[model samples]
Structure formats: structure tokens, C-alpha cells
Target: MKSKLSWFSVPYVIWMAIVVVVPILIMAVYSVTTAEGALTGENFVGMGDYAGVFLRSFRLAIIATLVCLLIGYPVSYWMAKEGLRFQRVAMALIMLPMWMNFLLRTYSWMSILENHGLLNQFFQKVGIIGLYNSLTGQSIEYFTMLRTPGAVVLGMVYNYLPFMILPIYSVILKLDVSLLEAAQDLGASGAQVFRKVILPLSLPGVLSGVTMVFVPSVSTFAISRLLGGGTQMMLGDLIEQQFLGGAYNPHLGAAISMVMMVIVVVCMAVMNHFGEGEEQAVML
Candidate 1:
């Protein structure tokens, strides 16, 4: 029976080998070897050149993940407690925008945030711009959010919010109501019950959500590029430059990827410690 089940997995195993394993092996080869194909440790040494990019990526990813958690947790918790109909409506409201392509959505923000964009025009027409201009004694065309790290963080939070929400929501949905009632019987107030029971039980979901958001946010290129105006180069931008941009250095790109992979693995390990191996349903 085991052998029969093993045969059924052949297709998926082959697919992983072709798509996942092959690319990883290729990256590993390039990560250690120079252009002339000589085996060397130079690639690892070169990573030092991009240290700032690595730091920026992690910083922005952490910021975005924390913001998502702060915003998403209460909303998800509320939804988890709501009636089924309200929950569906609220979830739909949160997710409807995600139906569109993420690139398209980000590009749309450019029109709203750019200098001389609709937002600026609205402020100008509403007289707020005039009031500010008079107070500052200067003419301002727009409030520009583009080309800023904060804008990049906002974009990341927008795109990845759903990933953070779903995991926590799933965990909350399955929370045992009896535990809450028991805590209440033991003289626990709402705050005490939440602190002692609800919050502790929700740790697994929170950890899963953080891992989901942070990994993608750290590795994302599109949001950083478009919102950050190609100026705020994070780790993803550095890797893209090596592989696809003017640099055209696959070896360097592979080295960056390896370092990033290691960082991600370390972060996951730390989160798993918090979770106590309690992660459920969320994909890594």
C-alpha cells in the first residue's frame, strides 16, 4: 500500500525536481562558481557589497508585517465573532480589491499618489492646498508619496494583508468557546480572559501570519520598484540588478538568493519557536 501511494506521488515529485529542485541546484552552482566556472568562494564574499540592500529589505518587510498584524488582528477577530452573513460581507470587502492583478493595483496607486495626481488636485480644489500654501508661503504642486520607503511599505501591506488575515482568521474560527466561558466562570474579566486564554491560543495564527507576510514582503520587487520609484533598492532589487538589469551577473544574483534563503529559514525557525510547532493550515 505504501509503494502504491509512493507511485501516485511520482508526478508531483518530478514536477518539484524540474521546477524547484533544478532552479535551486542551478543557483547553488552559480552561487559558488565564478563566470569562468571555476569553483570559488568569491560569490559569498561579494555579498558584503549588498549588505545595505539586505538590511533595507528586512527592515521594510518587518515594518510592513507589523503594520499588517496591528491592522488585521482586530478586524479578523471581529469577523471571527460576527454572524456568518456579516463575516462574509466584511471578508468580501477586504478581499474584493485583490481580485485585480497586484501590479495593476500598485500602478493605480501611482496615479493617486504622484505629484499633480488626483489626490493633489482634490486637495487643491478643496482649498486645503491653498490654506497650506498661504501658511507656508509657497506653491506646492502635490504631496508626493512615490519614491519613498514608506510608500513601498504601504504597498506591501496592501498586497499582503490578505495573507496575514486568513491564517489568524482560520485559527480564531476554530477557537474553543468553552475555554472562554470557563475563564469567565473563574472570575476573568473580558480583558483578563483575552490576555490569559484568547491571546495565548492565537499565537500560532499570529506566527503563521507574520511568516507569510514577511517572506513575500522581503522578496518582493514589484511593489518596491513601482512605489519606491526604482530608487529605494532592497535585496530584491539588488538580485534583479544582478540577474536581469545592466549588471547581468547570475553568479552574484545566485549569491544574493542564497543569503536571502538563509535569512528566511532563520526567521521561520524563530517564529516556529513562538508557535511551539503549533502552526496550522497556512502554507509556508
Candidate 2:
């Protein structure tokens, strides 16, 4: 009966093979096989694309993940403990921006950060300095804010915040209130209870949130292009350029994509290890 019912899944399985597995297989082949007039081992270059991504995208991803964790943890905790009304309001607010186009959100930051923009205007109004400072002159100092590495991080944090919050919120909502009460009853200070009990118990959510934020942020191209300009190219942008830009080198793009996949896989594995440890401790 189970075996017979499995036949119903055959279409879905074929779809997965066609859409997911086939693409991945093609990427893997492309990553190893170089462009040639004919298929040959001469085109196969080993580990170069992976090494380039590690040198470029890895640091940005690490920074973005850390920023998301720092910002998301406290917000998730507050929502979880503050009752359903507040939780609903907060979650709605977090998710509201997602309804707006992501590219529009990225571009909006440019309006505020551009040299003649709101931030500079606000500063000027407050008599901090003129908009045309000696360093920036009359020209918009997009490099200072819009095109900097900081912009990339800011864009990533903005884009991926909801991903981090939702998973962490789930973990926090399910936390055993009795454990918190027990810690308080045992003369644990508020800080001590949080550090020892709340933090440890929330590991699974934290891991899930980190994985969600890190993977997408690392692979996002629109954020980097819109916010960081040409200077702040991430691995995603590089892959995109190879595929869509005049370069038109899908082979190199695939190689870079594979590198990104490996990095995400490794980071998730490390987070999962710690998450499982916390779960086991809770069980014991």
C-alpha cells in the first residue's frame, strides 16, 4: 500500500530532479569543466573559483551573520515574552517591509545616504557642517555611505532581519517558562537566569535564524548592486556578472555558486552541532 502510494509522488520527484537535482548536477559539471571548443580535461581548473570566493565573499557573509544575530536575538526575546498582542504587532512590522519590493528598499537607502540627501541635510540644519564639506565637496559622497562596505552590511541586515527574527521567535515562544521560574527560585539573578537558561535554551532558534540569514545574504546580488555600487561586489554579484553581463561565462559563474554553497553548508553544520548539544542538555 505504501509502495503503491509512492507512485503518486513520482511526478513531484521528477520535478525535483528536473528543477533542483539537474541544475545542481550541471553546476557541478560546469564548475570543474572549463570552456573549450570541445569537451576536454584541459578546461578543468580545480579549486580556483572556490578560493576566490573565500577571499572575497566569506568575510562579508561572516560580518552580516554576526550583525543579524546581534540585532535579531534581543528583538525575538522581547516579542516572545511580551504577550501575543505585542508579538503580533512586532512580527507584522518586521514583515511589512517585505511586501515592498527589495530593490526599492535598497534604493531608498541611497536617498538618505547620498551626499545631498536627508542625512547630510539633517546634519546641515543642525549646524554640524555644510553639505558641501571639504572632503566631499558639492558632489554626492555616495562612496562614503552608499558604496562602502558598510552599505553592503547594512543592506544585508535590512534584507535578512525577518529571516533571523521568525526562527528565533519560534524557539523563544516554545521555551519552558518553568525553567525560567526554577532559575529565579534558586536565587539566580535576572542576568544569570538569562545567560544560563534563556540563552542556552534558545540555541536551536538561533541556529535556524543564523542559517536563514547567512545563506540568503551571502547569495543576494541586488542588495550589493543597488547599495554598494560597483566597488562592493560580492560573490553573488560576480556570478551574476558572469552569467548576465557581457562576460557570459556560465561555467565560472557555476564554480562561484558552488563555492558559496560549500561555505553555507559548513556554517550550518557548525551551528547545528551546537544546537544539537543544547537540545541534548535540555533533554537530560
Candidate 3:
């Protein structure tokens, strides 16, 4: 049985070597080489010129992750405490949008957030835009929501919010009911019980959700490109431009990708370190 299992694993190992390990090795080589195939350090050295882009990417990602957590945690907690049928219906509703094509979903937001889009039209009809203009003494016809940093953040939050909710919902749903009952019996107030018991226990899910949302949000190009109208460039967009766009600089692209990967790893490591302490508290 062991030998057969090992034989089965051989195919997976080969696949990883081809698709994962090989690409990483290629990227590493590209990052350290010039267009002429000569060794160079200029690729990494030039990253300093785009410090603002890196900071903007991280800021938007962090904002999106926090927004997802702020919205998802309560929703998850509510779902966990609901009846089975209700939970199923709610989950179905939550996941329904995801069934659509990712690009289509983003395109829909483009229509809604554009200057003359549905949201603006609705607000115009309702006199909100005019009212704001009147109060502020401005002549703006429509709110400039698209092609901005906020639009990119909104896109990230909309797309990745589910990733934040599902893990937290799963974790909160599986928490031991007896723990809540025991805490209540021991004269803990509702808020106290939640703070001392539920919140601490839910840290792992929060960490997982943060990772899921932040990783993609930080590296996303499609959302930034579509919604930002090329105004809000991110690390992923920078890398994509290098490899595929008119920039045509694979070495620099690889260097940017490598640095982004390292930052993500470091962030996750810090989060996991904090999570360890939270887990210890829960255990105690």
C-alpha cells in the first residue's frame, strides 16, 4: 500500500516540478539576469523608483481586507447562530455572485461606478448629487468614483469578501456550544463571554480570512485595471505590464514578483506569530 501510494505521489511531484518549481526557478533566474542574458543587480535596484506604487498597493489591500473583516465577521457570527435552513439559503445567496464570470462581475461594477452610470443616475434623480454640489458650492455633475483608489479598493472588497466570510463562518459554526453555556453559567455577561471566549477562539479564522483576502487583493491586476482606468497601478499590474504589456521587461517583472512574494510571506509570518499567542490564550 505504501509503495502504491508513493507511486501515485510521483505524478503529483512531477506536476509540481513542471508547473510550480520550474516557474519559480525561471523567475529567479530572470530576476538576476539582463535582457542580454548577462548577470545583473539593476533589476532589484530599480525597485526603489516605484516605492509609492508598492505603498499604494499595500494600503489598498489592507483597507480591503479590513473592510471584508468588518463586514464578514458579524455576518458569519449571525450565520453560525441561525437555523440550518436559513444558513443554507444565506450561504447560497452569498455564493451566487461567484458563480458568474469574474471578469463579468468586475465589468458590472464598472457600469455602476462610471460617471454616468446607474448609481450616478439614481443619485441624480434623487437630487443627492445636486444637493451636495449646492452645499459645497461645486459644479460637479457626477461623483468621481471610478478611476480612483477608492474604486480599486471597492473592487477588491467586493471580489474577496466571500473569501473572508466563508472561513470565519466555518470556524464560528463549529465552535463548542458547551463553552458558551459554561461561560454564561460562570456569571459572564454576554459581552464578556464573547470577548473572553468567542473572540479569542475565532482568531484563527480571522487570520485565515485576512490571508485569503489580502494575498489576492495585494496582487490583483484585473480589478485595478478595470476600475482604476490605469490611474491606480498596483504591483500585479506593474508585473503584468512588464511581462505582457508594452513595457516588455521580464527581468524587472520577475524582480517585482519576487519582492511582492517575500512581502506577502513576511506578512503571513507576522500574522501567524500573533495567532500563536491568541491560540495559547484560548488554550489557557
Candidate 4:
């Protein structure tokens, strides 16, 4: 049995080596070497020049994650508390956007948010923009949502909000009803039951959702390119520019990727550390 199981693991091991380990090893080597194949630290050293880009990427990712949390948590909780048919319908609606091509969905957002796009046109037709102009003493024709940092964040939130909702909803839905009953029997109010019981128990899902949302948001290139109009350059854009765009520097791109991987790993580790401590405290 052991021999057979070990034989079965061989295929997976080979797959991991080819797909994951080999690429990482190659990236590590490239990150530390120049185009001439000479080892150098300049790749990492030059990252300081793009500190503002790094900060902006993180700031936007954080905001998007927070917005997803604020919106998704309530929706998840509501879905979990609803009837089975309602939950199914809500889940279908939530997942409907994901069935479409990712780029198509983002492109649709571009159309909706452009200067004379559907949203502004509707607002103008309804006199909402005029009402705002009257109140603010200005003659702005179109709301400038596109080609801005907020547009990038909006794209991130729209694309990744489902990731946040699914994990949290699954966690909340699986919670034992008896636990809530016991809490209530012990004189806990509705808010207290949630704060003390549901909130603590559901934190793992929140952590998972945050990781899912933040990682992609931080590294997203297409959304920033389309929505930010090249104004907001995230790490992904910078890396792409080095490797694929006019910069054409694979070593620097690898260095940026490695550094980003390290930073994300460290941030996630720290976040998990605190989350675990909180979970443990709740357990105690």
C-alpha cells in the first residue's frame, strides 16, 4: 500500500517541479543576474525609485479589499440567514458575472464609467448631474470616474467582490445553529451573539477572502491599464513594462516579481499570525 501510494505521489511531485518549483528557481536566478549573466544586486536596489508606485498599489488594494468586505459581509450574512431558495438565487446572481469573460466584464465597466458613458448619461438625463452642479456652483458635464485611481479600485472591487462573498457565506452558512441558540440562552443579545460567536468563528473566511482579493488587486495590470489609463502604475504594470513593454528588462522584472512575492508572503504571514491569535482567544 505504501509503495503504491508513493508511486501515485511521483506524478504530482513531477508536476509541481515542472510547473511551480522550476519557474520559481528560474525567476530567482534571473532576479540576481544581469543580462550579461553576471550576478548583481542593482535590480533590487533600483526598486526604491518606484516606491510611490508600490505605496499606491498597496493603498488601492487595501481600499478595494475593505470595500469588498464592507459590502460582501452583509450580503453573505443575509444570504446565510435567508431561505434555501433565496440563497440559491442570490448565489446564482453573484456568480453570473464570473461566467462571463473577465476581460469582457472589465471592458463593460470601462464603457459604463467613461466620461460620456452610460452612468453619466443616465445621471445627466435624470438631472442628477445638473442638480449636483447647481448645489456645488460648477458646470461639470461629466463625472471623471475613468482614468483615475478610484476607477482602478472600483474595478478591483467589482471583479474580486465575489471572492470575498463566497468564502464568508460558506463559513457563515456552515455555522452550527446550536451555538447561536446556546448564546441566546445564556442571555446574549442579537448583536452580542454575532460579535462574540459568529464574528470570531467566521474570521478564517475573512482572512481567506482578504488574501484572495488583495493578492490579485495588488498585482493587477489590465484593470489599471484600462480603468486607470496608465495613470496608476501598480507593481504588475511596472513588471510588465520591464519585461514586455518598452523597458525590456527581464532581470528587473524577475526581481520585481520576487520582491512582490516576498512582500505578499510576509504580509499574509503577519495577518494570519494576528488572525490566529484572535481565533485562539475566542476559543479560550
Candidate 5:
């Protein structure tokens, strides 16, 4: 009973091999080998020079991912459990921002957060800024909000929050409502039900959200550039420089890309391991 559609994926598989696998292979080869094609460990060693950049990028990304999780879980749970009509609208609203270009969203944040921007102006007009200065006994007119790691994290969170929400929402939607009802029947509190049942069952979504948010946050150049400003650099910025900066070196860029790819693989494996742990928790 072979269906005609059984082989439908062959073209996609071939396209993926050509468009994705081939370039990665070329980059991997270029990374470890010198101009003379002699393999060396120096490329890996070179990673040390940008260690601070890596640390800062990961630190901010971890914070942003956690923040998204903290904010997204409740929202997703609420929305996923809503009436079908409202849920459809809520889903649409959540996806509305994504329909716009990502760069435009980041740029909008820049305008809002900049000094004398909408945020500051609104606070001032509302007298919140004056009250803050009076309470703190400081004569400061405006506080610096833009061009910092916090700003970078904010941009990452804003851009990737949907990624965290959507996966968790879908997972929650598919969850067996009976398990929740059974836990309730056992006299478990709302939080207890979530802890012992809902959360564990939603592990797949949580893992997906973390991967979706963290990977892009760790590797993002635009958010760091437009928000963190020129003063900060993520691995993406560093890699871009290696390739396109005045001192262009394709080999170094390729090496950095390879290292970044390894890190991504490790993070994904760690996330998967957490999903397994959650499965065990559910069984218990």
C-alpha cells in the first residue's frame, strides 16, 4: 500500500543538501585548514581572543530567554485554555507583530528607548520622572536607557518572545485536560497541578521555546548592534567582522562559525536532556 506521496520529500531532501549541507561542509573545511590546506588547531585557539564577547552574549541571552519563559508561560497557558473564539483572536494578536519585518521592530524599540524618546517623554508628561527625582533627591533630568546590555536583552526578548509563546501555547493546547481535572480531584492546588502535571507535560514546548529564543539571542548581531550599540559585540558581530571588516579573513570567520555551531549543538542536547528529565518527573 505505497501511497504516491510517500516520495514527496525527496526534492526537499535534495534541496536541503544543496542549500544547507554543502555550505556547512565548505565552511567546516575552511575553518580548521589553513590557506595551504594544512590542518591546524590555531583556529580554535583564536577563539580565546573573543571570549569576553562570547560570555557577554551568552549571559544576556540566558537572561532574555529566562525572562521570556517567565513572561510567556502564564500568557500561553491562559491563551491556550481560553474559549476557541478568543483563543483564535489572541493567537492572531500575538502573531500580528511578527508580520512586520524583524528589523523594523528592533528599530521601533530604538526610537522608543532613546533619550528624549517616547518612553522618557511619556514619563515626563505623566510627572513620574519628576516624582522619581524628588524621591531619590537627585537633579537628573533623564536616565540613560539605550545602548547597554539591558537594552540588548530587551530587544532580544521583544523580538523572540513570540517564539517562546507559540510553542508553549501549542503544547498546552494539545495537553490532556483530563490530567488537570484528575489532579484537581485529588485536592491538588492550582500551582501543585501545574508543577506535577501541566509543567511536566509542557516540557516539549518549553524546550522548543528555549532553543528558539536562546539560539537567536546568542547569535544575534542586529539586536546587539542597534540596541547595545557599537560598544558591545556578540559572536555574530565578531564573525561578521572577521569576514567583512577591513582585515577580512574567510578562514577566521569560518572557524568562528564552526565554533558557534558546536555551541548550538551542545545547547540543544542539554535542552533535550531536560525534556527527558521532565518525562521522568511526569511518570513519578
Candidate 6:
């Protein structure tokens, strides 16, 4: 018998079209269409903004993604493989920061990282460094910390680490113990078992976590605004500038957003391809 729910799908499809497809269509059109009253080739500008975004935001996103992987993988693996009660505690702790408002979290980092801030104070108390007489003292260069690229990466990591952790944890938790035992039975060393068995088995999680962390971290504007300031401009900040900072160029903003979307899609595709290859190799 034929399914009778075809009519029920219409409302959901229409909602998706209105919410997702329509905006994307508008953005695609805006990316190609020029601004009114502007000079020739001024509005869309083709791939120029995309190139600029690559040069500006690509490096920061890569760095942030790498840092998240480095930090998140170990935490996820440990929690999944070991620490039962502590795993819950760790997950709770990871998510606790998120419970607070995101802006507040970013601002909190500002206070901690500021030269004369609590971090420096704690360091001074521990005799790691001397107390700063001023916020700009040689020992406490808060201004540098406030508006720097490093801060941008730090903020991104702090904000998006949970995304990396959750996916990897899910994978790690579901990993077959038999595979690890079999590797051990075959005389594989600890490192060998991890490298050959655990790592390969966990590839799906790694891919998911990386994509989740990388895409949003790259596009996030709030962290950069609060932490990086004028010195470190990411694609999101640049797009915001076009929309809100007296530029009022929705056409340009749309073009940039479309480019960002393309980059995210391409990166995800490449990662997925690699992940599939790894999965195939593991299966073989």
C-alpha cells in the first residue's frame, strides 16, 4: 500500500523553503547582483570578498580548529574511556560556562586576560611575576591582550570547545572494546592500539566535532568584537561592519556571507571525504 502522508509533508517543506531556502536564494542573488547607484562591478565584486575572507579569517579558523581538536580530543577520550562519575562532572563543567550568557563569558575572559587583571595578580602572588604598577606596565600589557589575534583564537576555543567535545565523546563512548582487546591480543603496544584502532574508529567523531567547532568559531562575531577589537578582524566582523557600521551595504554583506557559506561547505566536504576514506580503510 502507498504511504498516505505525502500531503502532510507540504507544510514542513514550505516552512523549510521559507526559513532556509528563501534566505539562501536571496543571498545567492545578492552575491551576484551589484548595488544600486554604485559604480560598475562595485556591488557583488565576484570572488574578491571571498578571497579577502580567506586571507583574513582562514588562518584564525584553522588555528582555532586545531587548538580545539588538541584540547577537546584528549578530554573526550579520557572521559569516554575512563572517568565515569568524573565524565559527568567534566561534561557538566564544560557546559557550565555555556549556561552563563555568551557575551558575559567573552567579557569575563577580557577581565581575566587583562594585564593587571586577576590572572596577573594570581601570577604575582605565586612569584611567577612581579605586580604591575600600572595596567600598561612592562609586566602587564593589557592593551596588547585586549586587541590581539591570539585573543581571538583563545575566545573561539573557549566558546566552541564543547562542540568538539560532545561529538568526540559520543564516538568514543560507542567504540567497541573488542577491537581494542583484539589489538592487544595481537601484541600491539598501547600507543599502537590507539593509533591503529582507537583513532581510526573515532574518525567519525573527529570529523563531526571539527566541523561543528570550526564553522561557528570562524563565523562568530561576538568573541572577536569583545576580545580581538580593531587589530584582529574576522570575516564575521567584516560582514557586520558592512551591515551595521555606517556601510549599510547589505549587498556586500550578503556577498561576504555567501562566500563564508561556500568556504564552510567546501571545508566540510573535504573533511567528510577524508573521513570516508579513513572509514573505508578501517573497514578493509
The candidate scoring highest on lDDT is: 3
Model 5 residue 12 CA deviation in Å: 1.6
TM-score of 6: 0.86
lDDT at 268 for candidate 1? 97
Candidate 5, residues 100-154, lDDT tens digits: the string is: 9999999999899988988989888999889999999987766678898889999
Q: Name the lDDT value of residue 74 in candidate 1.
A: 92
Q: What is the lDDT of residue 39 in candidate 4?
A: 95
Name model 2 segments beyond 4 Å from true.
Answer: 1-11, 37-53, 130-143, 279-284
1-284: candidate 4 lDDT, tens digit per residue: 99999999999999999999999999999999999999999999998998998899899999999999999999999999999999999999999999999999999999999999999999999999999999999999999999999999999999999999999999899888999999999999999999999998889889989999999999999999999999988999999999899999999999999998999999999999979975575455
Which residue runs does candidate 5 get wrong by more than 4 Å?
1-6, 277-284
Candidate 4 — what's its lDDT?
0.94
Estimated TM-score for each candidate: 0.93, 0.86, 0.95, 0.95, 0.92, 0.86
For model 5, the local distance difference test gives 0.89
Give per-residue CA lDDT, model 2, range 222-249, as digits (tens). 8878877877777788889789988688
Global Cα lDDT for candidate 3: 0.95
> What range of 10 consecutive residues in model 5 has the weakest lDDT sum?
1-10
Per-residue alpha-carbon lDDT of candidate 6 for residues 56-122, written as tens digits (9 for 90 to 100)? 6888888999999999999899999776788888889999999999999899999988778777667
Candidate 4 structure, TM-score to reference: 0.95
In terms of TM-score, which candidate is stronger, 5 or 6?
5
Clashing pairs in 4: none
- Checking candidate 3 for backbone clashes, the offending pairs are none
Q: Model 4, which residues run further than 4 Å from truth?
A: 1-6, 277-284
